[model samples]
Target: MPQKKLMLLGGLRYLLPVIEEAHKLGVYVITADYLPDNIAHKYSDEYCNVSIIDKDAVLRAARELKIDGILSHAVDPGVTAAAYVAEKMGLPFQCSYEAACILQDKSLFRKFLSEHGFNCPKAKGYTNVEDALEDVGFFNWPVIVKPVDSAGSKGVTKVTDKADLKSAIETALSASITKNCIIEDFLDKVGAQSSADIFTVDGKLVYPAYSDQLFDKNAANPYTPAIEIWPASMEQKFQDDLTAQLQRLFTLLGVKSGIYNVESRVCSDGKAYIMEVSPRGGGNRIAELQDMATGQSLIVGEIKKALGMPMDDITAPQYDGVWCNFILHSSEEGSLVSIEIDPEFKSKYVRDVGLIVKPGDHITPFKGANNSLGTLFLRFETREELDAAISNPDSWVHIKLK
Candidate 1:
């Protein structure tokens, strides 16, 4: 049999490990995107210059390359395109083409959840600002306005007053490639929101792990997650309930054999609502952190399934210790000089501390996952210690810039 050929979308750093794993399995890898300068292209077996946002363009490139499988990880631009190509060419896929559309578009996803009896907030999509402004009164105060198709909090704004609604809509529409925006009620969170990674084999959920989302309220964009702790502080019963809800969702959508990074929240009403069900691996290295905490290979499983290989039973580990992954970023825009981590943080439990920007490199303030300078992965002996350190991170962690 000939080697399996995989065409990956976007050249982000997260694809680095996926490409390496494919190579180890003797699979041919082709990384495609308009930017050939992306780091992942340097490591891929081959690189194709095509814009991932243009579905037809990507499909054409995949056909010319004779790709056996098409998939994307940790990138939002290729989710729809991946499903489109796989469905058109008769390849194994995570979900149907129609379901992919619903998941990729925030407005469509909200409507789908509501129609399916999921506890989703009432939301609406718009193409123009005037229509959105006219219907602003439909929702109560404090709503979230965001691009219908973008991710990583790129164009998300929390609108409390009517005066800010129009500007928020314009911002969201500008971020959107389709010039679409969605508005929905912003739930009063019970505590921290949770983002987790779950995998399904043939539509059966096999492994599940949840993490408590940490936020930097002072960051440029306050909504973006700053730090995340594995084995979320949520009650076991609640976690189990969320897992069941996810199982129902994938089963309803006929999702099979792929990874999902799900965002959910227990609102002030004490009801769990599924916030977002991202069909691809999340951008913040959530899958990698999930693997480390749960002792399962989320990334490897995704790779195997994408190549149409057998999937072993991966169990969700009952984490005995806490793991933390900090989505490191700056709060100011300037050329980075260096990062200074205090000796207190250089513990033996520190797994890795990666900084993407070197001296003299321009670093943007935290707005989205794309603006992440790097990640800091560490393990703690106890949740108490983890809580203490994160509660007062300013005293130890410092970023130096000129």
Candidate 2:
């Protein structure tokens, strides 16, 4: 028999490790996207110039290639496209096409959660700014506005005043391909946000991993995750409650075998709320961090699930130490000169470093995951040390530029 073939959508750098994993297992890898110069295409066995956002077109390409399995690991658009192709081609899929639509669209997902009694923010979607502003007085102050379908916090905003509502809605509308945006009551978090990777197999939740989602308030886009700590700092009781809610959601939404990027928080009212759960690998090495902390390869598990292989590696994750990931970024735009990690923490704490840009490369201001300069992996001996470093990263790490 011929070797199994894997078709990956969107040629982002995150697909590189997936391509490598397929090659290691002797599977042919085909990367597809509209851009010809995407880095992942260089390592793939073949390249297809199909737009991942166009579900029907991508499905046609997959059929022509006779792909054994379809996957879109770390990219947002790939999630729905991969599901669409997989369902149409009779390939293994983690979630149904209907479920993907709900998870991909913020309006549908929020509505589903509220209807099902899941702890979710009161949200409503609108196609035009005028409609969104019409009911501004109905909501509490300090609301969040975001695109209905975009990811990476590309158009997320926190509006504390009614005067800023229209601009926020317009910003979100611009980012959404559907020209739709959601305005929701802002949740007051009790602690750092709980955002991490979770897994499921055959419609049953295998395990739920939690992380301490960190943010740089001074960041141009403060909604994006700036740092994440494994085995979150949340109380055990809250974590357990969150897990129960997640299981309910997985079963309700028909989430099948695969890794899921989930977000939640313990609110000030002492309730755990399921903020978002997307059926795709999160950008910025979340799966890699899960592998580092938990001894399980989410990437491999995703590949196996997509290819109809046994997911023997899907086990309860146990973190060996307090692990963390820092998404290195700059708030200013310029050519990179040199990246300097303060020697104070480098000798025994930092485990690995991935610098995506070299000296003299023009770098944009950090607004989303796409602007991340690189990632730093740390294995802390204690939780205190990890917390300290994360709370004040500027003192220990700095990216210099011209």
Candidate 3:
């Protein structure tokens, strides 16, 4: 048989590891992006300069290359293109084009969740400010106004009073790509950021990881705070119950196989209010963290699932390692002075250090994941060590923004 070919959509920064993992597994990888400078572009077997949003362009390129399987692990914008190609070619894809559209559009996703009996915050989508403003009172204090078609918290605002609602909606809608946003009840009642990333083999739920989430609340509008932990601190029973609910979602959504990343807030009452679910791997180096914590790479799992391989080989994590990732961000948007990740900090537990910022480079406060300076991936023997390391960013590298 010929070597399996993997087609990836999006640039290299976030998608690089997926390419690296594919190459490590001896798969022929093709990366597609509109820009030639995309990080993954250099590493792939073939690089195609094509717009990710143009489904026809992506499908044409995939056909020309005769790709074996198509997948985009961490990038959200590329998921629909990947799905379109996969569906057109009869290739193994985790979701349908309709499903991808639903997930990408917050309004549609909320409706779908409601139809399936999942508890979602009351929300309304609007392209016109007047329409959204009409239902301002629907939400109690601390309402969340966010872009309908944005991710990583871009244009997301928490309005605690009516006076701020209109401004927040305008701000969110202005930043939205679709010129629309959904206003929803803000569930600020937090406990842990728990997520269940599950895989189903032949329609059977295999493994689910539900862990507490840590975020930096200070990040800008579109860029919600970044995550910092996995295999989160939570009761085992909570995980099991959450797993059951996720399995039902998978079944309801017709997600038989492939990777699914679902975000939620496990309230103090232990209820998992569904936040969002992406039919792709977690972004911001979470895939690498998952591998470090579980001994299974989501990149490889995605490839295997696409190739119709048995899922059992890479199903669960073997080690009880704590996985944490932090995005290097600036206090203000400007120019970079210096990013100093000390050389003396190398250890077995520290799996990877990626620094995308260079001295003298112009830097900006993160507007979204796009503005992030870099990322850090860590693996620890115990939770205590992980907590200590995460709490002390002083010991970690610092990027001086001028």
Candidate 4:
């Protein structure tokens, strides 16, 4: 049999594990993006220089390379392109191109949820600032203004007053690839918001996982997640209810087998809302953390599915212990610095430390997930320990800037 060829869109470090898993399965991996210096390109078997957001360009490259499969794992900008390419080439993908488009755009997804009777915020999408400014009265006070197509909270803003809506809309539009933005009712969550990866097989959701997403209130963008703890503190009843609703949403969209990044929340209104669902691995190595906590490899499953190969039976995760992925970030922009972790904490709870920037490298304030310095994988014997440590992370984890 010929060696299978898999084309991956984007060159972020998140693709490293996907490349490793594909290699383990004896598949040829091609990493494609406009950046030749991306770290993932160094690890991939081959690199193709093409803008992943340009679906037609990617399709031309894929055809020239004679690729067998394609994926846009952990890369939000390429999900639609991957789906488009897959649909055009008859390759495996999580959903149809239309579905990917709807899910990738917050405004479209919100409309879908509303149309289908899923709990969602009152939201509206606008391509022009004039239209959005005109519709400010459509949303309640303290509404969230964000890009319809951006992720990692790059351009998310909370507007408590009408005077600030215009600036927020401009920020969101600047971050948006399509020059579009959404203004939505801010759903006051009861507790920590949930962001994690879930898996589906043949359009049936078989594995569901949730995490307590934390944020640094002092960060430049407070909406960006700073820490994610598995076994979400959300009540089991709510999780079950959300799962059922999620399955129904997928069924309505005709979603197929693949890993999906889902962001949900239990709002103060005594209702659960599914905020976002994208047909790709989430940034922040969410799938990787899920594997560490549950001993199941969504990475392998995703690769196999992308290549039209059989996947392992993916069941609901059974977490053995409390796990947390602490995103390493600096609060200010500066030159080379060192990250410090208390010796006792490092020895006891810290399982792995993945640093993206080295000492002396220029660092910037934590504006988005892309500005993060690294990640710390941690395991705790109890949730109490996890909570105490995370509550006072400065006591143990410190990033010294010069």
Candidate 5:
């Protein structure tokens, strides 16, 4: 029998595990992107040098390769393209191409939520700064401006004053691939925001895992998640409500079995809002962390589903203990000297440290997930210990820069 071919759309390090799983399943892995030097390509059986964001180009490559399935994985820019190719080839995908478009664009997602009577913030998308400035009064104070099509919080800004609106719009537009941006009322969350990966089967949510998405205010981009702890502190009632709403949203969109990166929050107004939902694994190794906390592997299940194979049994995860995935980054831009972790913390809490950079390598301040040096996996016996350690990471985790 011929080996099944799986075409992955991005070359990010996140695809490394997917490639490994595919190889374990006796499948051929092909990493596709314009960059030939991407790390995932090194591990893949073949490399396709085509722009993943260009759907037509990717479709051509997929046809030539005779691929059986395709996935975008943690790469946001290629989700729509992957869907397009999957639909054209009658392959498995989480949702249709149209649904992928709606989920991938922040502006369209907000509109969909509002139309569906979800707890959606008042927001507007703009292609030009002049028009957004003209409609400044449309939104409430303390609004967030972000690109309509970018992820990892690449161009997200919190603007409390009208004076900063135009510049924020420009920043968002620059980050956007479609030259579009959205201005929306910021939901002052009741507690820590939730950003984690969840799974669904036949449009019904099967696994719901939530995390307390943390950010470092001292970082260049406070919007990017700096640390994500499993078992979010959100009340159980709210979590249940959010899970039901997510299932409904998926059913309405005709979503099937796959993993989704979800961002939600309970606002001070006593309403739960689904901030964002994308049909792809989240960056920052969210699925990987879930595997550590629970004995289940979403990565393996996702690989199986992508290849038109029956998925492993997926159910609600029972976390063994509190866990956090700390994104390693620097507060200042310079050549790296070394990463220092307090001896006591390392011995007691830290489970693993993965560093991408070494001494003499140049590094930059944390602006987005792309700016991260690597990750640190830590397990805590209690939530209190986890909170205390993350709150004062400077005392234990230090990045010496020259």
Candidate 6:
């Protein structure tokens, strides 16, 4: 039999392992990105200079190359384009273009959640700044303003006052692909479920992943997720209940066979409200963490699912490990003086710790995930150790950015 040809939408940094795994399984890998310098572009059997969001161009390449399958994991924006090409090419990809459109649009997604009786924050979409400003007072104070179709928290803000509302709306709308954004009622008690990647091929009711988020109150000077730890610290029964509920929600939404990075927040009364669901792997190295926690690679599992292969051969482990991630965000903008991380601590359940900024590089306080300098990955035997290391950054190492 011929080796399967897998055409990946983006390049290596993340999708590399996905490509490597597929290649290891005797599948030919073809990668494409607008940037030829992308890390993954160099490693593929064939490379193309193409925009991932440009559906026609990607489809043309896939068809011309006679690709057996097309996939993307890290980039959420590329998922729809990949799905479009796969569906048009008569491949086994999940998610319809309409579904992708809806999921990509935060406003539309919130509407779907509301219609389905899921716990979702009150939100409304607006086409321009004026419309958003006029409708601002409809929701309570401390509204969340974010772009309708953007990721990595590129243009997200929370406004508790009228003066900041207009600016926040304009900022969010400026970053929107649709020239629109959503204004949501902010929940004071917030928590997010970073897991929701693994699921049964057809049922949509199977467990994917369930992770707890960690925030750095000092990074942005307010509060945002500086890290995320998975297999959540929640009670076993709570995890099971959440899984069952989320599975049912997915089944209701007709989702199947793909990895999803879902975000949700817990209300003051302990009700978990659905935030947004990306039909792709979680960002910030969470997928790798999920692998360590479950002993099953979520990306590989997704590939098996997309390929329609028998997945029962691989089983998720019961003994979960602690997976931790920390984002490096500067509190001020200046030249990178130095990062003093002890090399000896590399093996101390610290899976990976990388500082993307080097000496002489300019660093700025992070406004969002895109602005984050870098990330650190750690695997701990106990949660206590992980917490201690995260809480005491000085103990871990002094990150000195001038």
Most accurate candidate by TM-score: 4
Q: What C-alpha lDDT do the candidate models reach, one value each?
A: 0.86, 0.87, 0.75, 0.94, 0.92, 0.73
Candidate 2 lDDT over residue span 1-402, tens digit each: 798989999898788888988888888999999999999999999999998999999999999999999988878877888888899998888799999989989999999999999888889999998888889887777899999988888988999979999999999999998899999999999988977878898787787888898887877898888898988889989988988888888889777788888888999989998888888888888898788777889888888888887776577788989998889999889999889888868887888787789999999887888888989999997999887888787788888888
Give stretches of model 6 more than 4 Å off.
190-196, 221-224, 235-238, 312-319, 354-360
For candidate 5, give the lDDT: 0.92
Candidate 2: 10-residue stretch with minimal lDDT: 308-317
TM-score of each: 0.97, 0.97, 0.91, 0.99, 0.98, 0.91
lDDT for model 2? 0.87
Q: TM-score for model 5? A: 0.98
Model 4 ranges off by over 4 Å:
none
What is the clash count for each candidate, in the order shown? Answer: 0, 0, 11, 1, 0, 2
How many residue pairs in model 5 have overlapping backbones?
Answer: 0
Model 6 is weakest, by summed lDDT over 10 consecutive residues, at 312-321
What's the residue-level lDDT of 20 in candidate 3? Answer: 78
Ranked by lDDT, top first: 4, 5, 2, 1, 3, 6
For residues 175-243, write the lDDT of model 4, one tens digit per residue: 999999999998999998999999999999999888999999999889999999999999999999999
Q: Compared with the true structure, what per-residue lDDT tens digits does model 3 show for residues 1-402? A: 788888888875777778777787788988888898877888888888898878899999989988888887777778888888888998888878887888878998898888888877778788888888788667665678888876666788878778888888898888887798998877764567665465656556675666566666565543355556776676666666667776777677676577877776666554667688787887676666677668666667788788666544546545566777777776587778887766655555567778887878887766677677877777777889778766777686766776
lDDT of 6 by residue, 1-402 (tens): 877788888874777678778877777888888988887877788888899889998999888988887777878768888878877987766577677777778999889888887777889999888877778568977888889988777778888888888888888888876688899998876444444355456655455456677666666634456778766665555556556667766676666576777776566767766677777776666676667567667677777766666664334434356777777787788888887666766667667755556789988887777667777777778878777887777776666765
Runs in model 3 lying further than 4 Å from the true structure = 221-223, 268-270, 309-312, 341-349
Whose lDDT is higher: candidate 1's or candidate 2's?
2
Candidate 3 versus the native: TM-score?
A: 0.91
Off by more than 4 A, model 2:
none
Candidate 1 vs candidate 4: the lDDT winner is 4
Name the lDDT value of residue 200 in candidate 1: 82
Error of 5 at 189 (Å): 0.9
